[model samples]
Target chain A: MHIPDGYLDLSIAAVMWVLTALVIGLSLKKVAESKNLNVPLLGVISAAIFAAQMLNWPIPGGTSAHFVGGALAGILLGPYAGSIAMASVVAIQAFLYGDGGLIALGANLWNMAVVNVFVGWYIYRLLERYSKFGAAFVAGWLGITTAAIFVGIEAGLSASFRYPAFVAISAMGVWHGVLGLIEGFITAGIVSYIHSSRPDLEETSNAVISKVPVAFIGVMILLSPVFAYLAEIVGYSEPLENVAEEIGLAEKQSYTGIFPDYTIPGVNEYIGTLISGAVGVVIFLSLAFMRQHASAD
Target chain B: MHLLIEKTVKSATSYFQDFFIHEYSRKTYLHDVHPSIKLLGTLAFIILSISTFQVKKILLILASVYVLALNTGLDVGVLAKRSSLFAIFSFLIVLPVSVFERDVVYLITFPLRVFASISSLQLFILTTRFSEILYGLKKLRIPGMMIDIIWLTYRYTISMFRDLLSILVAREARRLKKTSHIETLKGGSKSLGLFLLRSFEKAEEIELAMNARGRKISYRGKYRAGFFYILYISGVATWWMML
Candidate 1:
C-alpha cells in the first residue's frame, strides 16, 4: 500500500502534500481545542499501533495478513488525534524502516492517516446505533478499501505510471476489499473486547456528526463526477506541461500522449477520466471529513 | 502458530535493536555533519533524481549515492541490498504497465529512480541519529508539538514492542493445545486489547512523571556545518544543477 517515490509524478505528490498539510493543520487545531489532549497517550498509542501492525492473523489459505489499524486508531481515539497518531506511525515507517518512500510520504500519510482514519470514524459513528460490532467491521473494511482506491487513483492519474486509472483501481480495490474482511473482523473483535472489559475507554470520542456535514458530504460526493467531467472537458494536463506548451518547449500532444492526455481507451476521454476521478472522490469524501457539534458531550 | 508469533517478535525486535545499535556505534565524519544539511541535501537529491526521466541522469545519481555511502563507511552492498527490495517491487508493479504500453524505458527508469531515492534516504538515516534528525527538523521550524510527539513515539516504540513480545510469550506459554483460526483470532485480539490498555496506563504514568519533572520537551543541538558537510552539499547541488 506504500507508494514508493518514483510511482507518483511530482505534481500528484505535491497535491497530496498540500491536502495532507491542510488536514493535519486542521487536526492539530481540533486536538488543541479538546480539553483532554494527552500528548503522551497519543504518542504511546501511536507506538502501540506501530508495533501491533507487526501482529499477523491467519487468512483462509496458508498465509497471514497484518492489521493496518487506521480505523482502529480513529475508533479508540478521536478522528483528529487518530490522524496525528497514524501520521507519526507512517512517518516513522518511512524514515526508520524505509518501508515507504520519502517523496511519497505525503501521499502515504494522506491515504492512511487522513482518508483511512476519518472514513473509518465516520462509518463507525454512522453505524454505531445499529450495531457496535458491525459498525466496526464495516469501518475497518471500508476504511482500508477506500484508502487502496485512492492509491490506485493517484497512480492511475500519473502519466509516469503505465497502468490506466481503472486497472489500477480494480487491482488495488479488489485485493484490499477481500483482505479487509479479516481487517473488519479483527477490528470488530478488538473493539468488542475493549468495550466489554473497559467501557470507559470505548467511547473516547465525543464528536457528533450533525445533519449539516452529512448533507455537505453528500453534495460533495454528488459533485465529484461533475467536477471530473468539467476538468476533463477542459483537457486537463499537468500544470507544468501547460507551461511547457505555452513556452513552446513542448508541443500540445493533448490527444495523443500516453496518459498526460487522461484518455481512456474505447470510451471517450471525458467519460473515462470522469468515471475514475468521480469514483475516487466518492470513496474519499464520503467519510473524509466530519463537522463536530460544538455542544456534544 | 507459536513459531509465527515468535518470528514476528524476533523480526520486530531485531529491526528496533539492530538499527539503534548500528547507528550509535558508528562515528564517521559524515556523522558529524549537521543533520539539517544532510536532510536538505537528501531531499534535493531525491527530487532531482525523480524529476528527470533520463536513465543516464538517474544512474548518475545512484552512483553518486553509492559512492557517498561507501565513503561514509556504510556497506554499499547492504544499502543496495536493502533498497533492492523496493526496486524489485517497483519493477514488478511497473512490469504490467511496460508490457501494456510496450515501453521498456518505464521498466528501467521507475525502478532505478526508486532505488536511488531509497538509497539516499537510507544513507541519511545511517549517518544521522534519530534524535539529531528530530533536532534538525526542529531547527527547520517544524511544529514543536509534532516533534515532541514523534520523539515520544520513537522512545516508546521499543518498550511497547517489548510489552507485545511478552504478551505473546505469556499467551503461548498458557496454551495447552493447538488453537483453531477462530481461537487464534480471539487470542490475538485479547493480546492487542490488553496491550492497548497497558499503553494507555503507561501514558498516564509518564504524563504524571513528566509533570513532576517539567512540561517542556525540547531538543538542544549545536548545529555546526563542517567542511565535509559543505563540500557534500555543494557537490550535490552541482550535480542537481548539471542535470
Candidate 2:
C-alpha cells in the first residue's frame, strides 16, 4: 500500500507533502503528549502492527492481502503513533523488500501512514460510538479501502499526465472500489475480535509515557546491517505458511503474487539493511530513555 | 539533438522516481547561488513545468525547464532519478481526481497542474536548506506564524519521540520483559491512550508559546522585500500571464 517515490508527478507529490506536513504540524503537539499518555505500550503496539503488516494474506476470491495498516494501528495507538508506526513499516518495506522507491517516500508516507491513521481513525470512531465492537470493524474496513482508492487514483492521474490524456483517474477506481468492500469486511472481523477480547487496553494507556535514555541513543549510533539477512530468512520461512492457513487467508496472497522471493544485496540493499537496524535501535533506545526520564520527572 | 535532449529530459524525470536517489557529486557548488534564488527559481520553474503538463502544450515548457535544469552545476543523474519519484507519487495522487469520472478538462488539468506545481516545490526543499528557504519565505512574507510553528514542532517532536522510546525500553527490561506476548499487547494499548492525552496537552503548550511570543504576522499587509520584492511580484505576474 506504500506508494514509494518516483511513482507520481513531482508537483502533485509536493502538494501531498505540504498537506501531510500540515496534518503532522497540527498533530505534532498531540503526538508528543501521546508518548506520556500510553507508556511503553506504544512500542509493543507498533511492533504488532509491524508484524501483522509483514504477513500479506489473500482475499477470499484470490488477490493478495496485506494488513489494514492505518486501521489496525489507529485502533490501538490512536492516530499519531499509528501514523509513525505505519511510516516505519513502509520504510522497512522500501529498504528490505524494495517494494517502493525512496523519493516517493513522502507520497507513500502520506497515502499509507497519513491516510490510514487520520482517515481510518475518524471513520472508525464514527462507527464505534454506537457499539463497542463496531469501531474495529469500521476502522479496519475504511482504513484499507481508503488506502486502495488513494493508490488507484494516483495511478490514473499519472497515466493521464504521462500519455493518452483521456485516460481518467476514476477509470481505475472501480477495481479499488470493489476491493474496498472485501477489505472492509475482513478488517472489521479482525478488529472486532481483537478489541473485544482486550478490554483493558481501552483504559490506563497514559501510565506508560516517560522521558528518553542515554544508553538507547548509544545503540542507535552503533546500529547497522542485520535486517536483510533477517528478511531473507523470513521470506523462506515456512512457519508463516501455516499462518494464513489458520486464518483461512491462504488464498489472498497466493493470487496477487504478493510474496516475491527477494535477495537483499548490493549498494541499496546494504544501506537499507543498515538503516532498518538503526531505525529499530533508535526506536527501542528512545523508548528506554523516555521511560526513565518520565518516571524521574 | 534538441528532441534527443527533450527525450532524455523526460526519461530523467521518471528516473528520479525509482529508488530514493541522493544528491550525487553535484554537491560541490552546493548553493553557489543564494538559497532564496534557488528556491524562487525552483518554484518558478515548477510553475512553468506544471503549467506545461496541464496545458498539454507541446511539452515545450517542461522540456525547457528540464534543459535549464541540465545547465546547472547540480547533479543531473541524481536529480533525474529524484524527480521521477515525485512525478509518480503526484501521478498517483492526481489519479483519483478522475473519480468525478465526468472527464472535465479542469479535473484533468487544474488538479493535476496544481499537484505538479508543488512537486517542483518539494524538489526545491530537498535541494535547499530550511534556513535559506525560511529567509526567502520571511523576505517574501509567507507568514512567520506557519514557519515558526514548523520549527517549534520539529524540536518538540524529536524531544517527545525520544522520550517515548526511553519509556518503552524500561518496560522491555523489567523481568526479562516476559509478560507473555499478550501482556506486551496490553502494555502497548495503554501507552497509546496515554500518548494521545499527552499529545493534546502538548498542543496547548505550543499554542501558549506562540501567544507569549506575540502571535502577530510580521508582514500582514504588503510584503517587505524592497526591490527584490518587485521582481518576485513580476515573476508571479508572468505565471498568471500564461493562464
Candidate 3:
C-alpha cells in the first residue's frame, strides 16, 4: 500500500503534505502536553510494530498475510501518540528501504499515519463499549480498508495514474477490505490476549479532545470550498480537474484565484506548488495557533 | 510447520541484518556528501523524474544512476536485481489497465519510471547511514521529537527482533508434533501476543532507566558538502535541463 514515486501528481502530493504536517504538528503538541511524555514507550511500540509486520501468518488456503496493526497501535496508544508512532514507522520505511517515494511521502503519511491511525482509533472507541474483540476486529479491518481507499483516491485523482477514480477506489477498497479480515483476526487476538494478560497496559489510551484541534479541523473544512475556488480561479487545472470535467462540474460553475493550480504566477508548477504549500502550511498553523491562544486567553 | 517457522526466522534475521549493512561498509566519497544535501538532491531527482513523461530522459537517468552506482563502489548487479524486481511488480499492477486501454506507451513507460525511481533511491540508501539521514531530516527542519521517535524505533526494532527470534526458536523447539496451518497460526498469534506483552514490559524498563539517567535521545552530526555533492547536484541539474 506504500505509494512509490512516479505514481502521483505533484498537486495531490502537495495537498497531502499540508494535511499530514497539520496532523503531525497537532499530534506532537498533544503528546508533549501530556503529564508523562513516555517517548521511549512510543518508540519501542513502534519498533515492535515494525518488526511484527515482518511476521507472516498462514491463512486457510495456504496463503499468508502480515499484520498491519494501525488499528492496534491506536487501540494500544491513544490517537495522538499512535499517529506519531505510525508516522515514524512510515518515515523509516521510506528512508531506509524506499518502500515509498520521497516525493510521495506526504500522501503516504497522510494515508497510513493520519487516516489509518485516527480511523482505527475512532472506530475502536465507538465500538468498544459493545464488544472489545468485535471493535478491534472491525477497527483493524476498516482501518486498512479506509487507508487503501484514500490511496485509491489520491492515485485516481492524479493524471499520472491511468485509471478513473471509481476503479481505483473499488480496486484498492475491495482488495484490502477482503485482505483486512486477517488483520482483523490478528488485532482481535492480540487485544484479547493483552486484555487477559496485562489489562493495565490497555488503559494507556488518552483520547481527550481539546478545543484547538476541533477548531482547526473546522476551519480547514470551511476553507476547502474557498481553496476549491482558488484552484478554479488560477486557471491551472489540477489532477482532480479531470474528474470535475468528466463529471461536468468544471463547466457548470466557475471561480478564479490569482494563483492558478495553487502555484505562484510565472513559476514552475512543481516548485510553485512547493512554495505555495509551505506558505499554506504556515498560514494554517498560524491560524490554529492563534485559535489555541485565544481560547487560552 | 518447520518450513514456516524457519522461513519467518530467516526472513526476520535478514531484515534485521539489512539495516546495518552500511555501518560496516568501506567509506566512499558518497559517504562524505552531506546527508541533507543528498536527501534534497535525491528527492529533487525523484520528483523531476516522475513529473516528466519523457521515456528517453527517464532511461538516461536510470543509466546514469547505474554508472554512478558502479563508480561509487555500489554493487550495480544487486541494485539492478532489486530494481528490476520492483519494476516487474509495478508493471504487473499496470498490466490490467494497459490491457484495458491497449496503450503500449503506458505499459512501457510506467515500469521504466518505477525502475528509475527505485534505482535512484537504492543508490541513496546503500550510500548513507540511516542515522545520518535522520540527522538530515533534522537539518531539513523536521520535528525533533519525531526524529527521536524514529531513532528509538530503529534501535528497539533490533532489540525486539532478537527477542522475537528467541521466542520463535523456543516455540519451534517445543512443538511436539506437526500441526495444521490453523494450529500454526494460532501458535504464531500466541507468540505474537507474548511478544507484545514483552515489548510493553521492555518499554516500562527503558522508561524508568531513561528517567534515572536524565538523558534525552538526540542525534548531532556535521554536514559538509564536498566535491561529490556538488557533482551530484550538477548532474541533477543537467538531467533537469535535458528533461
List all candidate RMSDs to the true structure. 12.9, 22.8, 11.3
Residue A26, candidate 3: Cα error in Å is: 0.9
True contacts kept of each: 0.41, 0.00, 0.47
TM-score of chain A for candidate 1? 0.73
- State each model's CA lDDT, in order: 0.75, 0.44, 0.75
lDDT of prediction 1: 0.75
Better of 1 and 3 by DockQ: 3
User: What docking class should model 3 receive?
Assistant: acceptable
Model 2 scores a TM of 0.41
TM-score of 1: 0.83
lDDT of 3 by residue, A1-297 (tens): 999987877666776777788888988988888754478888999999998888877667766777777888888887788888899899988988778888789889878887787788878888989999899889999999988988887787676778887898899999999988878877877888888888887667754656577456435533533442343344233333344345432332232442357764445779867755665455345334322322111
What does candidate 2's lDDT look like per residue over A193-276, in tens digits? 445555554442223323242123222112211221233234322222244345432332222221122211222556535544
Worst 10 residues of 1 chain B by lDDT: B234-243
Candidate 3 Cα misplacement greater than 4 A, ranges = A207-297, B1-4, B172-182
Q: What tens-digit string does per-residue lDDT give for candidate 2 at B1-243?
A: 122223323443443333133222233222333555555665454434433333432133344333333433344554455445544555455555545454555344544443344334444544444444455556665434334433333234334543444444454456352353334334533443344344445555655665688754232222222223223323332322222
Count backbone clashes in candidate 2. Answer: 88
- Docking level for model 1: acceptable
TM-score of each: 0.83, 0.41, 0.82
